[model samples]
Target: MARQPTSGHEGEAPQKLRTSRQVYDQIRWDPRLDPAAFVIGYETRESGAEEIGLPRFDPEGDIPWHRIRYIRQGTTTVWDRRSRVDLLEGKRSAPAPSAQCGLDARPVHRSALALIPPREAWAPIEAIRQAHDRHVERWMPHINLLYGFLPEAAFAEARGAIAAALRDVAPFEVTLDDVRRFQHRAGATVWLHPRSEPPGALEALQARLEALFPRCSEQSTVSAGGFTPHLSIAQLRGEDGEDGEALVAEWRRMLPITFQARAIHLLSRRGDEAFAIRHAVPLGEPSPEGGDR
Candidate 1:
């Protein structure tokens, strides 16, 4: 659960609350905007009140303020700059009515590339994912090949680039042989390791995509040099205790899950919203002489 912003009145004015450090770090700040200059506010009903906060803005500051028209769902908050522009330009005199917030909140689209396993594979994986991932219901089970923020304006160009990069790629098979754990500062993440020799077809596909659109790989924490092709099963927090380790061991025992990968899907969501498949590009059929790679 996410911490809701605290609200209080300074004299007759309502003060906007600063998000918690954890939530603040999760914010996908636009590269064009300065983090120091950005302040998030909720919308207030009162007209002609202070709706915007400046650099001196503080959640605990003694200042009279109104709300900004924005919606928060779960741990994610999203706001459109156009609303602020409208207010400033006198095109709008008051904040728009607040809408429902959370995962169910209206989606804003963004894009990524992933390899989706068939339903037979997804069924069991989804069960394990739900038990482990905090945001399991919001996302599907898939191997993320390339994930980046592709805005609608650049969607066509990005789609074209991805399609071209995968033009010669043939469909391949993946076998999840065992559970592997990667230790992180947060905790341990358990994943399904594909049974492939070093620098296999999956690696080759990722490399080709990275070469085509180098910028798409820029924001990823796992760099191309250290890329490991696997389907994430669960992200165990530090507090999950010995029970978490037991679960990982149990999953490892259920090894060698295999599936055929035929198409690369382009998935996207706005902010931290739920992802949906936007495009499916099929991998090239194997040549008669080569057979399935």
Candidate 2:
């Protein structure tokens, strides 16, 4: 018996299998390298009817996954997805690159209240952060006490309200004694987890802030769960496999650094602009008994 061949249409020509390859050059930053940095690239394809010429180095209009041989970030090959495919139906058009990763030249201003770590504790963490991506250094290590898209008009009122709410709270010590990993769909973040005895000061401060700024707490990602105090050390792409785990382990070994939280900072940024300290609200003075109450 003769076996019949499968066909989607009776008169259609057989789809020819082809190999497509593209190389993006001069890439300044790879998303895999720094989740914070913008994703940018150019592409060129080989063995296609569209055009066979010099490689295109223009900013990527879309991500040509089916045709991309590999994507290079800095001097590293960050991604590779290439395979043989039928080209008779023509190659699939690449979907437009996401606007989320696009670089915005204009600053977008915003404001928030946070507790930034002192330089003594931040220098080592900053080193690890920059090792992952130099750009991560732009953001200081901090625990957000309250953050939201606050307009300039409301900034003064918010700062005053926060100061009044925290006025009764005395300075306290926060011990970052362990390294933890915060996994997310976008990427994994290495963090310095703060530990304290029962009736934790960090939790207490967060509770007071939430009570004072219910709207901000409602809009926050960290507010859902009981407040977790931690400082971001580095952002990493999980695709890096053991490298990411190894980095987390290295940081874990450097546990137990303590610092006093003397003041809470009111930080602001315009739109996507870099954050700047707008006000520093000092905690209550220590009692005459030689200790904070």
Candidate 3:
């Protein structure tokens, strides 16, 4: 008989079959764009004005309000970021409560102490909400996205440092003086302006926060530079026109509105949900003698 054909495995140096290890062995972690990173920052709440045809998504109900931050982008994020942002606030047929972006009295004291005069603090929360309502009405949900990401440790430190810095300069009394406008990447926005001398308190806080969390720098997607810290009252979805200008002018005439700057809040936006309050850092503690500066 012809020599039995040798089994392919017999004497052949074992042919190395493709292995899972070989496939993933040299994969590199590219840091150019970290789509997997977690984002954290402050954002105002939205007043779900109209229910029209949109599904009712409750910002307060769906998302946690404090110590908030979530994955803004990446396949791994809990929900699709852009999709959630676009969802209308409520359903028209259902008439879900149209909640505005605002802080209730309870949260105000906890977040910022002696910073805003009680009356001053209360008024703007509503004022901002009204302004936001107008914008939303005209633009059908004018959402302003003020977002950034920080490593978890960096976030904790930065938030703490900023809070401490605010407390340090509390005596100066930063005031939110007027409404102003700026062109942002997403669109034009109307924000509250804080007028303070030496800008010392804000500056100090900025420096410290930046030193701790450099990832949110001006160059990053979550930029701190040119970020005039103001609660955004309204956002223009499209280009501003004479009509828009007229509308804004009408709003401007209504202004010269004022509020005391109390504290900076940390906010977060996950997948399809509107932004929620994460944590509120109190600016200063009032002592029996007066207020600690």
**Local distance difference test scores for all models:** 0.55, 0.53, 0.37
Give the TM-score of each candidate: 0.57, 0.56, 0.43
Candidate 1's displacement at residue 237, Å, is 2.7
**Candidate 3 residue spans exceeding 4 A from truth:** 1-167, 184-187, 198-200, 218-225, 237-240, 269-274, 284-293
Worst lDDT run of 10 residues, candidate 1, spans 82-91
- The model with the greater lDDT, 1 or 3, is 1
Q: What lDDT is reached at residue 92 by model 2?
A: 23
Q: What overall lDDT, based on C-alpha atoms, would model 1 receive against the true structure?
A: 0.55
- The TM-score that candidate 2 achieves is 0.56
Alpha-carbon error at 222 in model 3, in Å?
A: 7.0
Writing each residue's lDDT as its tens digit, candidate 3 over 129-240 gives: 5655443222111112122333222334445555655556453455556667766433466666666655665555554555544433331232334444554566675555
Between prediction 1 and prediction 2, the one with superior TM-score is 1
Query: Better model by lDDT, 2 or 3?
Result: 2
Model 3 clash tally, residue pairs: 12
lDDT of 2 by residue, 6-97 (tens): 34688876543332222221121122222212122224342222211112211211235454443433443344333222211212244223
Predicted candidate 1 versus true structure: per-residue lDDT over 5-104, tens digit per residue: 3335445543233323222223322333333444454443333223222222332222322334342333334333323211112223343322232211
